[model samples]
Target: MKISLVAPAASLFAGVVSAATGPFLTAVDSQTWIIGNEIWNMTQGPKYGVKLYYKDHDCVGNAVGHYVSYNGAANDLAWTSARIVKNGTHSGVPFIDILFTAAEGDMHWVIFSNQHGSYQYFVNRALPTLGEFRTLWRLDNTTFPNGRTVTKDGVLPPLADYLPENKIQDETWRTPDGKGYITKYDWTSWILAQDFYGVYGEETGFGSWYINPGKDYYNGDETKQELMVHRESATGDAVQLNMLHGTHFMVSSSDVFPQGKMWGPWLWYLNDGSRSDALSRSKTEFASWPYPWLEDEPYQTRGSVSGQLTLSDGRPASHAAVFLGDTLPSNKSSLDQGSTYYYTATTDASGHFTIPHVRVGSYGLQAWSGNNSAIEDVSSTFTLPSLTVSKNKETDLGALTWKISEKKKLFQVGSFDRFSYGFAHGGDPWQHGLVSSCPANLTYRVGCSTTKDWCFGQSTKGNWTIKFWNPATANANKSATLIVSLAGYSSGSSSTIWVNDAVVGNLTSGSVGSDGLVTHGLASDPSLYRSATAAGEWRYFEFEVKPGVLKEGKNEVKFQLTRETQWHGFMWDAIKLEW
Candidate 1:
């Protein structure tokens, strides 16, 4: 049996559109929506920032499918309440409306009501069904499970729904009651006016709107056709949605590891599952910059860069690692230098790569295909051409053809022999057991700080362990080079590590190298490195695991700070294994 709905009369809806009938206008255009008003100020840092990873997600822990995350510190602060207003009439269906208030830890995840003598709380739910919000608020206390008190489902109308069938166009839609028309715009395609690193490209023009899929709920369901978005701040950062699968293709850019930043985005299920009438163009597609993320001025304008890689014979260079750099590194140990190269991507089988949302500034690209080579113009002395990016523009370098040349390799270790693990490549994915919990140190950061990349050193855990399995039985006979980037207090503070339950070396000796990178036997001493050092900063250390020590599998490396110092005991940004 089909459920029948009674929608408000069109004439009645039109008349009530003004606050005169109630208190405020219910309908809002894309131009006048709450884009920045819902900023989710995260405190944990960048690792939680939006990038296209967690689309259509729910309120989960550190999982990759959450809509927003902030510092646990900000969880107790007061936030503004959001009020919903209807934009047009819907097909006749009776619905209820109410006010919602956030609860414990600013979990804003609550819909309140009273059932008899007990209270019902609806929070942290999946994306509510279209035309019917699964939660409403009135009273409060706290009950789990289902609620049947004074509650009515709220609804949000979607912009369009064309997928696996056709594209959507801008058109009017109505409620099942055939009494109202939805005229507000929802989806936005923000142009590349800024780089992914909070760097803007254009000052003004050809784009009034920017795209951000901020705070959304339950976005990654495969059963529905929905969209999701996340934006940290006002520029560069963005999230992509797959309306077909009702999810975001997060793993697309493997290097866009989460950092942490602001976020917001809300979506609705299409009235019709397989089709939509979404707008193909908007004022942004034409021109304008409504809101500018005012930070440092130059960080605002953004642009794009695209090019093809080919070998001397005209064949494409497939699977080449491409990097657009602000600074150059000496080698793998130059963790700080590598971070200066903000943009990183791998080429497709066709040898073509495009790095969009690049900060408009002076930059160069380096390609690694068995050898390190720069993409440069014929007359240029550098390996790469002096490239430039303009706001709302694409800097296209037709084809970068390369010929085999003598070069040094970053890693000479054999077959996946170099097991690279670090916060720079996204924190420890293996069994990193902790003897003590790490304290949330404020100085901890992403990219380069003290010439080190990212690390798990933002806390005061005296004993922490990072373990891995050397599964290659055939490769078990050789020694492994364990290079680590780390820092700690030198005032009675000491660094210690146990490989395979055996102590290797100790660093109480103040003089390791001018650069502060300590090396036991293999790798260059600090004096040999190009990185500059100061009193209190990060340093590098290389330790060669002795042969006959590492068995076939299940090897462990334990780290402990011998003496208590300051700032989270000891800190590290990366851990590299090369044999």
Candidate 2:
């Protein structure tokens, strides 16, 4: 299958060193150092420090903090402390470039300041142990998959040669410009540290340590990462390489996941460019950048937004999630909305919310109240007027109330938190086959069934049913409203609502939802990413239930989807009926 380019944000790496004393180590000159089967030639390109940007969420929005020099505490062991030599700004966003030393063992750390205050960025959790480091090596004279030799710099050779026979299969696609090709390959291997040290490390090797690509340069906490090799022409023409995991190159080698590879679909982008140029480009591409978006980009100014929400009953809508976006509510999330600004925040106990570090722009507001038993009776999404946000300023949206249609409450199932938090088979939705492994008759009955009776997701159509009973006082004469809140969906996913053997309505999940069924994850999980999406957002569908549709007796509301493959399905947040 062909895949498109997905640009996450970029990570900058400054100083990385690999030291070992063995027969495989050799120094060609002051500009070249050959260690084992790998060669590091400093003369090939200019060396530069890595840039670090501090933002609230990952690499999103303008820099919230600035980096000063490192703390350099003497009590810290493992020589994991790197240095920050310089600080600068791009488009008014402050950033720092860090440097490291290879004394005893190469370790690096950087200090940054945000709205909270200045703090040291610990590499491995909050502990002061072995500091992790990353090195960017431009492969020169490497073997290609077609049995050809790549003489220039910035190439890849079937991953590091130390890996055991990987049995990797390569898939290639021609570049859009028709000038080069991008190859996708799978790398499955891990380094046994004891064996690795014996072959590479000097005597008095440390006991336990975790070393991978620097966090400032890449996400050191990702599993299931992959590697993509790009080949460009010798004419110095810019060749774009699309990566799924945002950053170009990343590696994790240690004792993290002993059962198997700690990483999932990890990725590495290989191209020809100076280390300085690569580091600079990474800072520019940090978060909110969609695929195919590169240099000469526009940076959005930072701002904050605050508001208060209350239910129609005048009670505070506590613990609700508020969303701000440039466009009206749709299936598209901020990640898929390309250039469209989106921000999120959660409401406090008093129904007040403040979304900080939002890119300066005009936005419409939407809020979803889920998991709150006190406000579970409320239906439909809450929306407010469009407001403009100014740089370095706060936009206060006065207290607004969410009012649902005046109708008699009939029945409800599950809570609307935009997630399948309490459902059966909900935790770790990625395990086994979410579709085939589900129970044949996934029927959930009200009163008799608990939250554990309902499955989190549905890939099979007409297999799931919600059985509810209508009492003598039930109101079936007036038209009813049936709300279906979505937790996740696949591409081209749609579902039909059936009530008491009568057709109710259908919902088409737009192009911006997670394929959680096939991906084996929830839409909100960071690890749940597709080519065109960063993270999935929650959405709800409201269908008008005719007067005669929902009867005053036993009622069965069935949810069916257009299931064609394992990737087609929908994960529900909640289902409610009001007459």
Candidate 3:
């Protein structure tokens, strides 16, 4: 079985809705109903207020009973005498009698007695179940006949102001361990007022008292030896008290002060079963003035690549292989099929690839094999400077380049996944085309290539340039260039270069010839560029940028690659960046 706890209905409306009735309603007309000799009614247009009535015992007649008023509205009320009801002799205290009424609006009643004290009752709209009740006065020695004079006025000083500021000295009692100890002292030397801490409790009767020592308490044999006690406070009058049994204190009002009456800032330690071993004296004073405390904010980082790819003819290209390399090629000889070092990827149908959670570092990029050919390839390298990628910020690498292939099939000859490549030539090609296989040095091949002309059949190769800019900052920008040169060729064929969507710039490829070089500028707002050259010999390609395009703060510049054909080998070299 399962049970759920809910707030009491009385607390919901603060006792506004009486359980006996629904709720009260106010009216304009004045009317009255007689409950015994007491006339009860609404006055002054049913406004919210409290009222008092003075009468002798016979005036109300009933000792205990309930009454209902029915003039213009209904009112449920109950009344009882001040007599206390007792339970088991010493088991618990007695209950006090009270009068209660439920009206439409806010109203309350105050009961006072010449011999007893005063108490206030409220029909709280905030606590419907437990009608509000507060004790305003209590019978004590100070307020008794020969005690301090009484005042009906409401003004009163703060409790702390009337209490002594000094700590009292006492005799300490030890526990079994000899470490745990307690001391007892009396406040009669400094206090002449009544005991304010002693308040009324339902179960303990009207005069029951509870004390807080603002420190720890102990229990043990006290008859063995007397322990000197030291005070913890800084000022006022002091008195010495003796500790008995480590639990009780021997205090006498007459022995410590001139006045026979004893008023106290009493101290007591409770040993209730649940808190026996863990219990300590209450720190009530410290609770009044608590200590102070500070708090901090939270922190995160992420990465991604733009979606989309562009061809050399300036059209969106889908399904292109894109690779990301960690380091730039060292020299022209490093752009070989089996010699180059980098990580790679392929673009989706939307020409986009997302690499999430990328670390901050340098990188080289390439794209290939889009239209099932080995003729088109583009490559570029860049560095993401020291950037602190905090939560919510995005670093964008604008674009990367891939060189185009000249063969009928856009890919070189044998380009598998983005990571590795193959060529169809055996001769030492310029763009670092490795010789993987050779049939008597005629049918030369590299990687997984089959034809010598497809791999080493070009004179000058294409070049790609990339310009990176950090839009997050004003002076954040940088540029990198990649050149792929072909050393041999049979004929000149137009090679298609596919730039990833993040690439921005002219889509046309510049021509190259034997022992000649072609250069292109990548210039576009919020974009980088990638391009491929026709099958041929090429040399000395350069990429430069105005300082400050790449920033020091959080920044991103992306370069993606795509191929016109599926199988082809592309080389990358002269990969350099200017600031």
Least well predicted 10-residue stretch by lDDT in candidate 1: 140-149
Tens-digit lDDT string for candidate 1 (172-216): 234344443331112211111111111111211001111222211
- Candidate 3 has what TM-score? 0.20
Best by lDDT: 2
> For residues 101-218, could you state the per-residue lDDT of candidate 2 as single tens digits?
3322222222122211111121222221221222221111121121110111222322233222322212233344444333322111111100100000112111111122212122
Sequence-dependent TM-score of model 2: 0.49
Q: What is the C-alpha RMSD of each candidate to the true structure, in Å?
A: 20.6, 17.8, 36.2
lDDT (Cα atoms) of all candidates against the true structure: 0.31, 0.40, 0.24
Candidate 2 local distance difference test against the native: 0.40
> Residue 43 in candidate 1 has what lDDT?
15
Q: Please list the residue runs of candidate 3 whose C-alpha ends up more than 4 Å from where it truly belongs after superposition.
A: 1-301, 317-343, 360-437, 443-579
**Model 3, range 205-256, lDDT digits (tens) per residue?**
2221222221111111111111111121222111112221111111100111
Order the numbered candidates by TM-score, best leading.
2, 1, 3
